[model samples]
Target: MDLKVDPEEMDCNQPVPVEVFASRSTLHGLSHILTYERICIKRCLWILFFMGSLSFLVCVCVDRVQFYFEYPHVTKLDEVSAPVMIFPAITVCNLNSFRFRSVTRNDLYHAGELLALLNRRYEIRDPHLVEESVMETLKFKADFHNFKPRPFNMFEFYDRTGHDIKDMLLACHYRGMECGAENFDVVSHRLSETHNLILASSHAGEP
Candidate 1:
């Protein structure tokens, strides 16, 4: 038997092969998978970035909190007393070193004794002069009585040579002391005189 082919009917109803349909379906599924993978990768990157930023912020906050806790805030006038010693025997290289070694009560007493000796040697008769000299010796600037209490770190004043006496004297002037410069000169002279007297006395005693 002979089979007859109809061109018009074949053209009107062209049947797609199963393989081609499967291939098209596979391509569409592959495209969806690729899109999903890209989205997932982008999401993962964003999450990682966010986590890193959060960790950095947390670390900064913790550091700040630790600093705040370690150093108590100064808010009272009594808390801001005069420096015990204007010139320490040992020098501090930095503020951190000064913080580690603060002034003690014994240091304050020694400073007071030195001030008393200076007063006696200088023959300072005026009460105000005596008070001013004491304050200056303790690194307390003039008008300290009226100074507003605020958070202060004495270590900030420490230079490589522990505490610079010249700087402290300058601070005294800036803080409203009228005779800071003169006082410094007078105290320096008196200290020199006292040193000479001690040496002379020691020599006499040896004889």
Candidate 2:
């Protein structure tokens, strides 16, 4: 005896149901759980595993959702009465920065051909081609990241151009009470070249 399946019967117009999708899905043992016809030990085990996995995932999602909503803190406002607070030490800095007029002619003279070339470039004139270039020019290297010592005195330049605290702070006060220049000792910032600083002395508590 021989059996044959008809092509017409195999090719149905009806869409494949969700059971087919479940069978092909990545969910481990779900196909087995759904397809199992009877109450066997294997089917019960798959059902238990699937439910436990789903529950754990739902708990994690709930925890993450709670964390997202609770990210910002609550704000509150209140009124209180207290004695006047001390005026903080103020430092004025960098009022006049990199003034071209302050650039001394001495620096331009020391800068030599580099500044000359730039000046020529500004005037739309090409650089003068030197037939006999110096050994230093031939072996020239440029590194912008590392700080190099300036040919000119940076300290003098900063002092001449940087801001003055006496000029900046015309008046000082705490809770409408006036403060004098004696309270602020004018000082240069030790760590930097450009900032003019003022420090409040320990005698700030004195009347």
Candidate 3:
């Protein structure tokens, strides 16, 4: 038998071989290998998902156990009635003025009464501790937050004098006002509002 092959149909004047055709015909076998590879990938994904879920459940369980174990102590503390005194706000120009006679009269009276109550309640006799308690009580006054009207520079004063009592006092006064207006009461009120709204929304969402 004679076979006729066209030159135009050949690559570089050589006819295409049967082995090359056979190789091309068997290329579909690679698809089966790919299907097995996909199955392996799916199995690996399932294993990873199961492990992640298990780890998350374990963490939740540990947190629940810790929270419950601390609940009894928290409840006991909540039951104890502590003495609390509410003081009216004092409006003062500065801390130095606050230490004076005219500006802090009502504040001083309430403060002294609160101190006596605290001393009777806690039986604390130390002078330094008593002084600290008096200061802490005074801090509760509403006008405490409104006095320091501006921010004073500390870094500049420290740079100039090495240490300046007057500058530091001014900074403290400024900070107290800032705390009242910007840091303490305003933020606390906002936070409380936000928390209450969130809680209300959550309760609404629940049954």
Candidate 4:
């Protein structure tokens, strides 16, 4: 007996299926989608980070602006019935050499007496030292925050008369003078107020 073989049946042994190709194409599409999603997530995270940094910067700026604008309450010496006497540690800068020295109550009192004498038109034997003392006293008072009035220009007063507070004090020591009441009164009053404030602040920290 002789057997007959078909040519199409031999080709069908290596047949390619449509389902395998479809599954491979589907896997490529899913991979592309996953990559796109990862990029989107990264962009969202970066945006959020930038926004947080911007928000912090804005908050800091606002807080600094508020701090600069706001003024703390300062109690006047006259407001207290009996003002406490406090000798705060003062650093005095010498005008000639620009050297600094620690000032004591004695130094202040001596300067005040000299100021009083100048107010009374009494001649100062050592005008130079007296001038130095007055400048140091003024500088010490100025060190205390808000002791002087706002827009207080020290240079303006200094430029008027050889940068000498002594001359200014001598000229306007008496009442009805060109600059009104004695400059010593202004200095003393401010000094007293500054002293009281210092005392109050020091005692505030006490138990």
Candidate 5:
């Protein structure tokens, strides 16, 4: 068979098969794979992240609901007196380590006892901790201040009290050192004067 081809159609450099066109059109190279695959992978990752974020939000809401329902009686403040008025104002002055602004009497008593223990055992004190512990006790105040509470004005309190709460804590820490507690000084270094005072005053009455 004489298969004579036209000169215009017979470019010797050109590939003869239709597969040449198909191969060129298909994405077979590394560049093609990277460009196409990257977009697909990124889209899948974003979807997964979105799902995880939504699930986390749902979990937080569920926890809040559970807490509110579980402690309905504790949330009630109608019978609870004003923490500022009921608790001795003198104790509220310098303690910053303790959360005290909106606590109940029961909490205050508990904190006071704890403070007394720290003082009696280690000769330590921190007024701020005592005050904070007081606030922790008062249901209404503590719950209200559960978010960001007003910061204690330490300088103002210190000036009014004429007692350096830090000094009191340091004195206790020295006592702890005598008992071979190396960590006591480190704790005292971290806490402010107010905190030290609270530790000192925590357990003054109970034997």
Candidate 6:
């Protein structure tokens, strides 16, 4: 069989391996052999060096291949017993964070508007550009400038703006028994800056 390489869908081209290899190959010894320089011992040494290097490379490849399939531990299913499951706390926060109906007009105008504006401070160019209702809120009906804010009460403020657990739980039963807001604990949410309230199942210790 002819060893000459064939070009795809083109004329078959025969490349002289010895001549091409000598010209293009990076190997130093092969060129010397091609040039016919009378150094028999040097040629022998190059051959032995290449054979030994090939053997070493092959051994390294085989070793790595053998180690590739090796695992630290075998994977197998094992049965394990787990007892005493604790009830998880589910946080129930109001979709509408601030309840306008619960909050007083004055508080909504002064503190509520302030809170709303504070959230959108970076986004708004002018306070006048804000919603007409919000602008009207800032502008007092009796007096334009005079706006008195109430005393800061953490619990009271949260109670006014945030939703109550009692209002949410119309009907709830824990383990076939009647349950109410008393079963849950009131907690401040992170998103509300600890000013708004959220309901969570009180840790009763049993699931």
Question: Which numbered prediction scores highest in TM-score against the true structure?
Answer: 6
TM-score of each: 0.20, 0.32, 0.19, 0.20, 0.18, 0.37
Candidate 2 on 142-167: residue-level lDDT in tens? 21235344566655655654555655
Clashes (N, CA, C under 3 Å) per candidate: 0, 0, 2, 0, 33, 0
Per residue, candidate 4 scores C-alpha lDDT tens digits across 14-66 of: 66554445445654333333242457766566567666777998999999899
RMSD of each: 23.1, 14.6, 25.2, 21.6, 22.4, 16.9
Best by lDDT: 6
Candidate 6 regions with alpha-carbon error over 4 angstroms: 1-91, 117-147, 153-155, 189-207
Q: Considering lDDT, where higher is better, how would the candidates rank from best to worst? A: 6, 2, 5, 1, 4, 3
> Candidate 5 on 6-87: residue-level lDDT in tens?
8777787666554454345653332332333457766566567666777898999999999888976545456755756421
**Which pairs in model 3 have colliding backbones?**
145-180, 148-177
In angstroms, how far off is 182's CA in candidate 1?
28
lDDT comparison, 1 vs 6, better candidate: 6
Worst 10 residues of 4 by lDDT: 190-199
**Residue 123, candidate 3: C-alpha displacement in angstroms:** 30
* Alpha-carbon lDDT, every model: 0.39, 0.56, 0.38, 0.39, 0.41, 0.57
Q: Against the correct fold, how does model 3 do in TM-score?
A: 0.19
Clashing pairs in 2: none
| lDDT accuracy of residue 162 in candidate 5 | 40
Model 6 over residues 128-190: C-alpha lDDT tens digits? 667776555444432324657556654566566776677766776555666566667665543
Error of 1 at 10 (Å): 53
